[model samples]
Target: MSEALQILQKYWKHDRFRPLQQEIIDSVLSGQDTFALMPTGGGKSICFQIPAMVNKGICLVISPLIALMKDQVANLQKRDIKAIALTGGIKSNEMIDLLDNCQFGNYKFLYLSPERLQSDWILDRIKNLPINLIAIDEAHCVSQWGHDFRPAYLKISGLKDHFPNVPFLALTATATPKAKEEIITELGLHNPKLFQKSFARKNIAYMVFETDDKLFRIEQILKKNPQSSIIYVRNRKSCLEISTQLRYLGFKATFYHGGLSSKEKDKNMLLWMQDEVQVIVATNAFGMGIDKSNVKTVIHIQLPENLENYYQEAGRSGRNGDKAFAVLLTNPSDIAQTENQFINILPDKAFLNSIYIKLCNYFQIAYGEGINEQFSFNLNAFCLKYKFPVLKTYNAMQFLDRQGVITLSQEFSEKITLQFIIPSKEVIRYTSLNPHDEEILLAILRTYPGIYEMQTAFNLPLIAKKSNHPETQIYAVLQKLKEKGIIDYHSRNNDSTLIFNEIREDERTINRVAKYLENQNTLKKEQFKSVLKYIKEDKVCKSKLILNYFGEKTTEDCGICSYCITKKNKKTNTIPLSKEILLIITNEELNSREIQNRINNKSDDVIFAIQQLLENEKIILKPNNKYILKL
Candidate 1:
């Protein structure tokens, strides 16, 4: 048994390995750059983790998502493995301490977001550590051609020079052959071992429903399945509204989106995880590291921007090796909405330039002024004040973030309400005459967390939500407490965005780059339509069609697909065309339908004959489905 197999057995308690896992692990163990294109549930993590565990040094993992990093670190720790996360939430002093521990501690894994690569301290100190492998999760992000390209990913290839001997391992759940090639080139892999798994998942049944009434369809889907499922919408408002509707339908539903307060998000997530909630209506923000094993269904209320995202998101269900359903519900009008979204997106170069200029102005710095300054920004307000479209501004900021010009941290922020914990000093002396008012002050302190940490004004809604006391009563108590000077009570709320670390302005405007980017966006719109074509196509086996997309040749259609299902229902008794049967025909060549007419069978029966004859090179097929016998 190999070290990886042994580790898998010892840690994961699995007696046998799955199909492609061992091959992938062997490639990694050989100390070569490895690209593993396993399907979503194909144990992509263990391939790297086992090698990391048995290897001589720490495996540095660069992930695009903060939540995914945190989840992986937590899971590793649960397995008695030492791991650390270099993320934004940590204070500078805390980061220093964590880095020190990573350098000296027995930590086997250190997960950092790609954006963190620009940190001077991280870059300066990493060369000193005994790093054996650099695992790039979501490796497709390195390619502009990929659906989810990140500018930060392009910078990661630079690490090869700093650690010349460290092997690079890039892993992703979905990638086309083009994406695969780009990942390899961008990572600077020298003759890397590529492990490409079949994109087929037998247990998942793909069904698409065209519907004009989305809410009715959702309600109907829920009424039928009622199992734990995820309802994915395109935006934040939909998440809240759909979840609320599910609740009204008397279903236990919760919602998740980037817009929610951190506390509410966490609480709601916990509720769903513990099965306190049976359904979660959410935006794409919901399911990166969600490890629920038995999600019986995953329904997409809206079409994703691309197939890669849809595959990854839908693949989240039926992980327990149980049969599950993945459905896409779309109305014809959605095409207009999607088209509008694509057209409204900012040109990448233009957006980046705007960000550079705005950051320069906001920080009171000259064009080249920003070097290492890090400051929080309100993206919406900034865009509004600058008269820029918010959606375009947000995408630009994201592009800038990917370009290493900024770091956008997805954080959980909450609104908090506080009632005065105590009366004013002058009133406290007077209130000391009566204990009832003093009890109110004590109750106020008990109600709110971290209220004294800041002196910012708070909102009344927050107080109403938190105090379990009426808003009017809380306000009265706050006024009395203010009068007595016992404590300051107020409401506070916070929103988060990516903070850029760039020169306030750039002398070199990349307008040419923006034009090129605009062209690419136009190309992506066409590509997105291709994805739609693939999903809506009902004539080919799902697996074979996907395989064909990646340049795989498999003549055998998967007997279990939407195409196969339709064929089966036709119940045409198809017979294979043997050489003996073909020789009986008088003509040297024949159209397949004409041949079928001679055979006195349905056109469906002719398909098998056509496929077999073509495969055997006994005949040539013309563009119009006519066939000619080989000499």
Candidate 2:
């Protein structure tokens, strides 16, 4: 067996490598910086993991989402491979201990959030470690012009200054031509080889339906598939409403949004993953790092803001190489709503200034003084309190982020807390009945006085270790205590922070990147508008339209699109409204509405017949309200 295949079987329990995956792994192993563009479910992780496992030193994986980090670490440990993650959710002592393990323990992989890159200690520690390779997941975030840009990702190139010999692997599921170039340039890869898999999914049929009744369309889609499916919406309220409608239709459906507590999110996800729930109605927060293989369909209830987001979210279906469907339901009204959203997103200079002033007022902090201060933002609540337009205000804040004035974290962020629900006296009584938990319970009560007083929010894992209890058992005990009316437990959430990171924003510094980003936005807007063109175009095949948009040069039509099906079975164009029918209607001289009622045919067909008669000079639209024959 080949060496790569040998490692794949021993670790991942697979005999073969996925398409283009082996090529990527081989490039990174050869000490060359690699750029990989694979569609979703193309096995992007194994590209880095296989090479990391074969190399001598630890691989540093820089990711933006904490949930993704946790997932990868868990999967790695399941194979008895040593992996660790450094994130903000843990206690400071725990973070230090984790860092210690990375430095001393024989760990093969270390996953970290991009925000940690700005820390002086993390950089210093990384410089000392014998790092082998650096992998940047979702590498498109490095480009400010990209749809999902992150400021912390800009600092990733600095690692090369410390470890000049380590090759970097940048991987992403979706990126435009512009984003791909920016990623390669920003990373300063040493003659990096780019591996690109085709963005086309042949087995997945794509279609767009224009309808005034999107909710009805969603119901129809669910009824047709009736299997594992995901419905994507734009916000939290819609997620719940659509899920409720699905359940009313007698389908097992669940809802997920950023607003849910971690416990709630986990419970919903577990139910769906276990096949106990047949459908999940969710916002954009639902798909990141999800590995379900049987999602037979993905339906978008509302149009996404851009194509990159739409493509990424829609690409979640058909992972198993089976025939799946992706549908987008919209109407004239939705187009207007989508345009208003984009127009509201303009980075107006004056609006940005007002936002700067509001931040100072909202936080009650002077200029250059809000550093290290964390505040919660409720968009509607803030707008109502300040009498500002909520939609426009959010757009202005995004512009401020681009201007380097503040940082905005859109995910539902909150202070995390882990506390015992029982009082000291009740704990003593319960411990006497359950001696087995006595030692662990006493240790917890002694180590965490703040939990007893309800003074601060704590992390549960830290408390579990301090109490010498299994993490899973501690969670169950906390739940049992809460059910007994001992105390209430609340989970953590993601929040946005406005940091005075750059003390000042000079126009020259901001305009350089802003101009580039604006052009990129223009291109994306044009791309989304073309989907409407495809819907109305009479001659173009749907599959050919999409492939051409992605710059595929093709003359032949795909034999599977709606256009192909319609072309293969053409209908005769016979007019049922004959001259005799028109003559009877003319004799009556009915009004346009009454003429349609007398015809006993579709109003559209009647209208078409009237136009043909007028063109042939057989009839005329009279001055008042009747059609008269030219004779």
Candidate 3:
């Protein structure tokens, strides 16, 4: 066995690689820069991981999502592999320690966000490390034509200049031909080998239903296929509402979104993963690193902004190669809503400038100051204070982040830990004086150890369960304890981190990037139109349409998709008419109207069968407008 194969077996316990995985790995091992285009759930990670294990030095992975990076690092550590992810919001000292570990602690994999590359300190330190290969995940984001474009990715090509000999590997689940070319050109990949897996999933039955009663349709689908499923919504409110509705209908369902605390998210995800919940209704924030193979369905309740997002999300189903369904539920209003929500309301240059200036002022950063400073920003507070629309403001922040003006690290549900500030005797005395808080304090002390000496992870739900108190009541008690100086407590909440990449610039600076914003708006409008087209058009095969959109051509129809099935039903329903037409044409000559009147089928069916019979020579059309059977 090859060394890579042996390592894969040892760690991943896989005997073989999925299609195109080993080929891509071989390309990487040959020290050739390679670009891999594999669909979602195609095991793209193993391609780089196995090669990194077989090589001598660490593999540096640049990814876009902090959650994905953290999940991969945790998984690798479980297998006794040394991997570390340096995401945003890390203290400088912690970052120094992490880099030190990567350089000297035998760490084989280092994952960091693309924005981290902008730091001269980080890049300088990375140059000193014994780097074997550079891997870029979500490589399509580097292209202007791609669905999710990030300007930080354009800086990735600089790594080549620093690491002159190291090969690079770029991986993405969805990319068009233009995006593919741009990825190669922008990343400066040297004569790269390209490996593309077919964008077709035969096991997935792509379906789109236009209905006013989506809830009824969803219930019917769940009743028919009571298996593991994910229902994607557009926002947090819908996620919770849909999940609640599913539960009321007797389904074991859970909800997930960015608004949930980290502990709550983990608990809900664990329940769904363990089959305790049949469905997970969530926003797009869920499912980045989810590896559930038996997810039999992925239903989109709202129209996605583009085909790329839809394909990636729907491809999460049927990973185990079993029959699964990717059902998109939409009404007429959803089409218009999607267009207006995504394309029509894009922040213009002036609005973006206003947001930028407000953001700087919010942080009390003087103009031409605050470069590289990180702050915990409350987005709701900022929006409320400025009377700005929440969604538009958030989109503007994303636009600014894309333009490399600032980096926004979204709220992570990382658990909070706390330690007591006073002695145990002091705590007992205080609790005795306040008997109302005694039960909670005693429960905390009994349920968690090292609370006095170390900052232990505070599990509110678990503590509530143990203390036989409602979670809200427990939270109140914890706050009371914190106020009384009995014990330190940290509550989990959603708070985003903002890192200023450059000094605050004048409004004129915004004009410099106005063209870029306009171009992006145009691209977004085009993408939204494509999505609308996908939803409104019913004649084309869904799978075929998606494949073509992704730059793959296919003449054959997936016989199992919604359109193919409808066509099959139409063909089946006409079979009886063909039989009846032959029966009527035995030896007697008859005209078309006579045959149509005699046959009990629809007139159209009779005409179609007559055309079929004449084409097959089973009957002949006479000059007198009569049909007769041939010997």
Query: Highest TM-score, which number?
Result: 3
Model 1 TM-score relative to the real fold: 0.74
lDDT of 3: 0.85
Q: Write the per-residue lDDT of candidate 1 for residues 409-512, one digit (tens) a residue.
A: 65423333333444345445755786655554445445534455433234444445444556577668767766766565544446564454655447364542
Q: Write one digit per residue (lDDT tens) for candidate 3, span 1-631.
A: 8898899899999999889988999999999999999999999999899999999999999998888999999999999999999987788899999999999999999999888888889999999999999999999999989988888899999999999789899999999999999999999999999999999999999987654457767887888899999999997657867887788889999989886777989999999999999999998999897889999999998999888989999999999999999999866567678766887678999899999999988889998898988888767657757878877888888888877788887663424456789998898888889888778778889976667865565656566666778878987877776787766667666568898888888686688777878878888888887887787666789889899998889989898887777566566556677777778778587876677678776544565566556657877765455677877
Model 2, 401-424: lDDT tens digits are 544456566653323444555667
Candidate ordering by lDDT (highest first): 3, 2, 1
Instruction: Write down the worst ten-residue block by lDDT for model 3.
Output: 409-418
Model 2: which ten-residue window has the lowest total lDDT? 501-510
- List residue ranges in candidate 1 displaced over 4 A: 89-93, 261-263, 411-492, 507-516, 519-523, 535-538, 541-545, 550-631
Model 3 misplacement above 4 A: 412-493, 572-631
Q: lDDT of each structure? A: 0.71, 0.73, 0.85
Q: Which residue segments of model 2 deviate by more than 4 Å?
A: 89-94, 398-524, 534-538, 569-631
Q: Which candidate model has the greater TM-score, 1 or 3?
A: 3
- Report model 2's TM-score to 2 decimal places: 0.74
Instruction: Please tell me which predicted candidate would have the highest lDDT against the true structure.
Output: 3
